[model samples]
Target: MDFTNLLATEVQTFINQNIDSDINRLLLKRSSFPNVTIQEIVQQIKGRKVAQRKFPFLLNENIIFPPNLNLEQASSQSTAEYKAKDIKGKSFLDLTSGFGIDAFFLSQNFEEVTLVEQNPELIKIVEHNWKTLNRKADFINQNLEEFLESLGQAANDDFRKFDVVYLDPARRDQNNKKKFLLEDLSPNLLEIEEQLHSISDKIIVKLSPLIDISYLVSELQNINEIKIIAVRNEVKELVLIIENKPSTVNQQPTTISCINLESDEPEFSFYINEEKTATSEFSESLDFLYIPNNSMLKAGAFNIISKKFGLKKLHPNTHFYTSEHKLDNFPGRILQVEKIDGKDLKKNDQFNIISKNYPLKPDEIKKKYKLKDGGKRYLIFTQSINGKEILRSV
Candidate 1:
């Protein structure tokens, strides 16, 4: 796809002028410029809109955006920058560069960078954008499996070895439905892990948050770290860092890092096996309630968190914790709460409802209580050692 006409000054200005325009109406209107169609112009407009938040670096002129699917799958600038912070090497290779967002940032610290993508048009767009941004990379339009095979078949003297290799495999299948298992991903990590290790000692793969950490630990070899990255308390990406280690030394436990970016929460790290021996102290309602962040919850360090923070778990299943005295710098939300009776909640009252390990969901609780949502106060419906309990934020 030639984006020359779409990069024209007038078209760029049009896209800028109507950044907030309705897409349906824009599609109904015909393009005034002969070189560009309404669809093309709208695509640029959509890209600019997404760039305003997702990847501000691409807001420059002549930067082309791919279709919605590619944009949707691309890593956000925050996450890419976070992942790239400690990564620096002489050579870097990105095996599955969808929109090149991760590649752009991850390759910054490397002296040499290469990007391989199966989509020709998307690769062209990425190449063009990289050039426009004054960054350099060897962009290859080829399937990653074949690329790995070629690298393996290279003559001994001509063989390449990147200091760091990265892959964010496509999680969607042919029907565009999302898949979570290691075997379901494109380029199938299980099949290519050995080959990837041959090319680079450090191989990093970004996975869907839906993937089970235990399954990954069991299937993958020599995993050094598993990072759970979240933005604003919402879990976003699960990154696995694999290193080629000797069989005798590979039995070391994997380190798990739970990070909640753009928040005051501290980063929580624990060994993958540490949670197994950790135990929790059960207690009834206390003065303050602690709710672990999504990343910590996803890490399943329920007992570990209670032990570390010196808080008591409310129940065996409930993740809620309580402490008599306020704990500073807990990596989650802390609210002053008190046990409340069901009769205390009045009809049509508005409160932020949180239901965890409870029989009814928030919506069902709302319906039965005749309550509205969103307010300064919170109604926590959960179980404690005594049984089902209701607590209200003070």
Candidate 2:
């Protein structure tokens, strides 16, 4: 699509003025500009609104945005920046640069950058926006598999090896249904894994948080590290780092890093072998209760966390940990809690209810105890070594 009309001073002014306007209502209206359709205008409006929170750097005048799907699939500015911090190399290549959000940031530390994307229109939008932002990259509008094939040619001057290769494969299938397996993703990481390792010494692939870490370790080769990243308390993406190099060790332990970005929580990293050997000591409720962050919980480092922090697990199944004293450096919420009876819960008492590994959900527990939600106080319904217990934050 020609972005000239969308970048017009009058069109941009109208979009900015109506940024907070109703999109559906605007879609019903007729186009004011003969060159641009109302639908196109609405697309820009939606893109601007999304960019406000997702990628604020794209809020420039000449920057063009693709469809809503592209914006939605693109990585947020926070995550992209975090991923780019430690990645520095001479050449960077992004295999599946859907919207170039990750590529734009990940390529910052590289002298040369190449972006390979199958969608011509989306790649054109990225090229235009990158030019507007004064960022330079060799944007190749071709399928990633074809590009990989081109790189296999020793005599092909157009294709060369990169220091680091990044891929955020399309997670959705032809029907727009979300996929969780490596085989299901576009460019099928499993099929291209060999080619990827042959081309770059370091390869970073962003996978869904829902994908099983153990399954990833078992399926992929040259697995150097797996970083589970979360923004605040919500798990965002699982970054799999592959290093293609000769090693004397027959199967080295994978380093798993649980990073809670945008929070004061310190990053928790451990080896898969350590977690396998680590054991947890069970105990009843103690003075302080520790709730693991989403990334740690997703990492399944329950035993290692208990062992490492000198804390005791409430039960075999319940992930909540407790200690007589507080550990300030713990990578999650630490609350001063005491065991309470059901009689202590009065009618209409306001609390932030939490139910974990218990018979009932949070809403059910609230209704059963006749409690109101949202407050500084916390009411936790969970299992202990003794049995089910109610904990109230003091």
Candidate 3:
């Protein structure tokens, strides 16, 4: 049968049984299921597996899941909560609201939330799920530029001013290639910045984590804050908050916050200059190695981190730090030096392996040394400050 959306209940139930099974293995024996195509079944299973952690609302019966790519690009539950934190608003407008995940969360903080998506199929799915989830939001199918023009045309003072206007622009180009620049995004946020500011004093735009923080701040005006969102140590999203400032003549330094939801208390923040001018001492060999999580690393506060924490860097380029004394409140994993090796590992056949700024990759090291992944001890391989490949254990 031609599909309009996700699979039916009966099909979903069948998928639930073999959801954890190998997708490739199932495709090999595709003939077993004659009534339904293997592609549909696989899609149902894969989509559900992804939603188990990303958006649990899909667990609800009758709610349809979008393509895996959409799910991958959509904000996670934790990230959405973090982005919406302290987001003061009486009404919210999402210009390029995709799958409606952010809109759903943003609606909780605002009295009224409007999501605009030009894709009819996506909007239809979101509208259906919004009702299923018992969430209220006005869903509109229109281009972001057109929506803003309509607001100007109405010219009605009766229209309530949005406390915050949110935009998560399409990060893909005409060929469906992933785009990284703000100008490359659909609606070219830079082009409509004035219009967006005219409609609302406060604006929040979700950007790629790979964006250069300095470049972003320079290109956009009135940006007050930049938040790097990370989960389980992996940097996921970058959020830029724009506010109306009184003086356009002078620009203030933007606050950069690195937030990780992995640990119990997960926030490491600092200013851009703090990272630039700060300096760290060098260490010849390993005593205790400390590697900051993806969030801290992405924040690019390397020198400030080392100087503030009283740590030394092995090599100028290697971000890994070391210290003779154990330090608390470190933003990342701290491992003690169990052993240091100049050649191939001679002791401890079974140990976890970590290679950083070295010629050999983790897989190659594992394969060559015949070592497993996890153990009580850790074997780290890196190039020292003296430019020698050194191996250390912790």
lDDT of 2 by residue, 354-384 (tens): 9989999999988888999999999999999
* Predicted candidate 1, C-alpha RMSD: 1.4
Q: Over the full model, what C-alpha lDDT does candidate 1 score relative to the true structure? A: 0.92
- For residues 1-394, write the lDDT of model 1, one tens digit per residue: 6887888899888888988999989999999899999998898889889999999988887788889989999999999999998899899999999999999999999889999999999999999999999999999999999999899888873247989999999999999999999999997999988898888889999999999999999999899999999999989999999999877764679999999999999999999888999999999879999999999999999999988888999998999999999998998999999998999889999999999999999999999999999989999999999999999999
Considering every candidate listed, which one attains the maximal lDDT? Answer: 1
The candidates, ranked best first by TM-score, are 2, 1, 3
- List the candidate 3 regions with Cα displacement exceeding 4 Å: 1-46, 158-160, 248-251, 363-374, 386-391
For candidate 2, the per-residue lDDT at 19 reads 95
RMSD of 2: 1.3
The candidate 2 region of ten consecutive residues with least summed lDDT is 152-161
lDDT of candidate 2 at residue 178, scale 0 to 100: 97
lDDT of each: 0.92, 0.91, 0.79
